[model samples]
Each structure stands twice: as structure tokens, then as C-alpha cells.
Target: MTQDSRQSVYERITATIAAAIEAGAGDFRMPWHTDGTMSAHPVNITTGKPYRGINTIALWAAAQGAGYGSAIWGTYRQWAACGAQVRRGEKAALVVFWKIDEREEDAGDMDDGQSDPRRRVLARGYPVFNAAQVEGYTPPPLPALPASARIAHAERFFAALGVTVREGGTRACYIPARDEIRLPPFAAFRDPIAYYATLAHEATHWTGHPDRCARELKGRFGSESYAAEELVAELGAAYLCADLGLACEPRPDHAAYVASWLTVLRNDARAIFTAAAQAQRAADWMHARQPFAA
Candidate 1:
């Protein structure tokens, strides 16, 4: 894709997500949500490979808006190849991928502090329809899981992280000063999943402490940096929850930060990329601390 097309790609995706946030203001249900699938990343039906980076956010937003329960999505040609047909009147979701091309270059790898002329980075986008939009593709439905399940695995995994977690409080938060995590008694949460999900979120925050990952964690509650950090923690929690097979539902409390995130993304189209990368780092940090494979 050309530079102009790449700009259009970012604008188009940002617009789609911005519109979804506007429509979901009251309900607070949109992208960054998972249900019975237990936080499975959206995957392409043809490739059966999970999307990464901004495409994850875009597809999740599209699926949530379209009420697609199955996480399978594919392009028109891909759907046909998979023996599935996109139903008439169904709209396709936008998905982007990076394409690298090689051309003739000088002997030196770098020229005048610029990248090698032989290599080029291209941002390409295509349309993909979710399983719900495909007529002949019946993705096996995920069994409904009751609110009550053994979250003991999650508890054990997180507890082994070696972070200082203290109970007994109405709010759950991470204290960067002392690198401590505080949460209400486990019994206070309506379900074990909620309790562990919240814990996972705070633990992600704790990973960003200055003594640890040392991310930009000093921003006040409503600042852009603060919103960015929260987005990282949210995405990190989603990654962790998926690994632990736990529902990573969007919390109503995070509604206040959505506008800030939108502002950051609208001002800088690449903000989502940075957020996703940092989130991956945060999740990796937590995962590395796990005592052992469960």
C-alpha cells in the first residue's frame, strides 16, 4: 500500500472504533470484551491463526458490534475456500496486515542514516466477514460456563508472581510507591472470575512499577499517560485471562478512561500499536514470573 492508503487505513479503523465507543456509551460493551470463549483472540477461519496488534482491536470491535459469538472471521475469497459463503447484506470487517518487500539496494545496509533501500514496510488492509456473517460455516458453539468455576488455577498462577498482594479493601488498585497490590476480600466479589480478573488487572499494573518493568506509571488518574497505562493493563489482563482460560469482561469502571484512550488514538493513529506492544511486554513480564507451568 502507498503512504496515502496507509493513512486511510488508520483513519478508517479509528473511525470505526470511535463510532462503536459512541454507540456503546451507556452499555460499555464493545471491543476489549470476552464472554464464554474465555478471552480467545479473534482468529481467521481460513488460516486458523489469531490476529495480532491493532487488527485484534479492530476485529473485536467489529464482532462485538455485530454480536458475533464465534471468533472466526475470514475474507470473502478465504470464506469461499473454507466452503463458507458470506450472507448477502452482511458487511465485512476491516483487517490490516503488514507486508514487507525487498528491492535492489546499495552495498551498505544503511544510507545517510536511513533504512536500507532494499526493504520497505507497507500497511495493507482487507475486508473480513465473521462466522456469523458466513452462511455455511457453523462454528461449534462454545459451551456456556456458569459464573461459578474453579478460579483456583488463576489464583495460584497470580499468587506465584511474587508481587505483594494485600486483601481487605473496597477498591482494587496497584501502588507504585511500594510496588503493592490491594484488593477487597475475595468474598466481596460476586464471582470468583471477577475477583481473579480484577486481581489480574492490578497485577498487570504492578508489573509496571518503577522497580520492575518501569513503565510511565506516574501519570495522574485522568492524564493521557494514565489512560495509556490503563489500556496497557487492560490488554495485559486480557492476555493473561486468555492464557488462564478466564472470561476477561470489560469493567464498567473503565468507561471513564475510554474517552481518554479515544483522544490519544485520534490524535496519534499509531497510539494503539504502542499500547498493544506495551501490553504484550506487561503480560510477558507477568508470565515470566509464573512459578511453573500449571
Candidate 2:
């Protein structure tokens, strides 16, 4: 395909995935159990058992939203691809993969179902290509980098929110329950520019804890509620990252529970809006906490 043609195809796939996630159609799997049971298994970090019924699925989804934000998968570009296979009876297993630019030497020896080694390989800024070889199709150029001054300012802003800043990695933010706020290893930051973008994301999560905004913040991974929370956090980070000129990260895990989130949003359009508003507030709150330079 011509370069432009390839780009168009990539964009179309990305858009389709985004649309599915927005509608809550791809977050959890309806696994067909051996004992004639259908259960919801979250697509992110796998759990041992399945969620027994729709009620359990809904509850799990909600808790995930409260704790993780709106989208469980993280962000948009992180998404690689999603596909489904029919098992037996009225059940199917859905598979989703996140794009990883770095390859680990140890990954070859590790067993399947173990913690992904790639998760530990710090991301090195936005728009890292998965390469057509990795994705089974050609992809467009990485998303544009946000302006720099704004990103620097955002870094300082997040530092004020108590998150330690690091450089050279993809955008990743986490709430270290014990520490005030710790950035992942500097090696994890693959590039200098994404530092602030990632910090903004973690800062949003910190907003959910009891000592901070006290959002609900609990859910079984991949439930409808969890998907919603992922969306909230995802959007929150996106807004903050945008203000500071950073590309929004991808949320590959969101594919598993996209359908669930859409259902909830459709059921209460106002709820989605409210969650986004609150997430924005949380981001602002973190920003305001930063210390002014001397």
C-alpha cells in the first residue's frame, strides 16, 4: 500500500477500536466455563475465578471505575488489537494485546500468563511504533509530540502535587500507597518529553484515594464499572496531557470492557459527563498543589 493508503488504514483501525471502547463493547470476556457457566473475566490482569453473573459484572465494573478511573486499559495508543474466538456453547473468549516497543531479553524464557515483562520496560514517550511486523499490519506515524514549554511546566506542576519526576519513558503514573508519590525508574521513562505527560496520569489516580478526592476506586479488573473508571482516568490524563502538549497514551486493556462502559454511559449520559468533570477537577487539584519556583 502507498504510505498515505497505509496511514488511512491504520487510522481507521484505531478509530474503530476507540469507538468500540467508548461504547463499552470490549472490556471483559464472557468465558464459557466447564460446568455450564458463563462468567466475566477481566482482560487486564487476569484473576483466578470468573465473575458469576451480570450483577457481579456490573459491581466489578463500578468498583474498577471508582479506583482506576474510567478506562482499564490505560490509553488509546497502547491498544494493539482485539479479536474473539468462539469456545463451546454460548460463550466466547476475547483477546487483546497492548503495543510494546521495547523487547526484553528475558521474555523468551518466561512462562505464559506471568506478569508481562514489557510492562517493566519503561515507555520512552508517545508514538513509539509497534512496527508492521509486531502488529500484523502497517501503522501510521506516531502521534505528534505536544509543545515543550507546556510539558516542562506540567512537570513542575506535578512535582508540586508530590509526584517525583523522572525522564525518558512512556507516560505512566501510579499512586504508591506508601510513598508520597514515586515516579517509576528513570529507565522506564524512555524519553525526556513524556515525563510530565505520565506524571499527569498518576496524579489523576492519586486524586481518587481517601486522603485526596476519596473516589470509590475499587473494582474487579475488566468489569463494566472498572471500564468506566478507566475512562475517567484516561480522559483526565488526556485533558491534562493536552494542556501540557503531550499525546494521550493508549489503553489496550480498555478493549476488553468497552462494551460495558458504553452501556453504562448510554444508560446515563449525564454520568459520563459528570465523571469527566470530576476527573478534570482532580487533575486541576493536583496541578494546584505544586510549589511555585523560587
Give the runs in model 1 whose Cα sits over 4 Å from its true position: 38-40, 100-120, 141-150, 210-212, 217-223, 288-294
Q: What overall lDDT, based on C-alpha atoms, would model 2 receive against the true structure? A: 0.41
- Model 1 agreement with the true structure over 132-217: per-residue lDDT tens digits: 88777767656655444437778778778887888996989998777799999989988788888898889888877767777763
Worst 10 residues of 1 by lDDT: 105-114
TM-score of each model, paired residue for residue: 0.81, 0.43
Give the poorly placed runs of model 2, Cα more than 4 Å off.
1-148, 164-176, 179-184, 217-224, 251-257, 291-294
Worst 10 residues of 2 by lDDT: 30-39
Evaluate residue 6 in candidate 2 and report its C-alpha lDDT on the 0 to 100 scale: 37
- The TM-score obtained by model 1 is 0.81
For candidate 1, give the lDDT of residue 250: 68
Candidate with best TM-score: 1
For residues 215-243, write the lDDT of model 2, one tens digit per residue: 66343222455555665566566556544
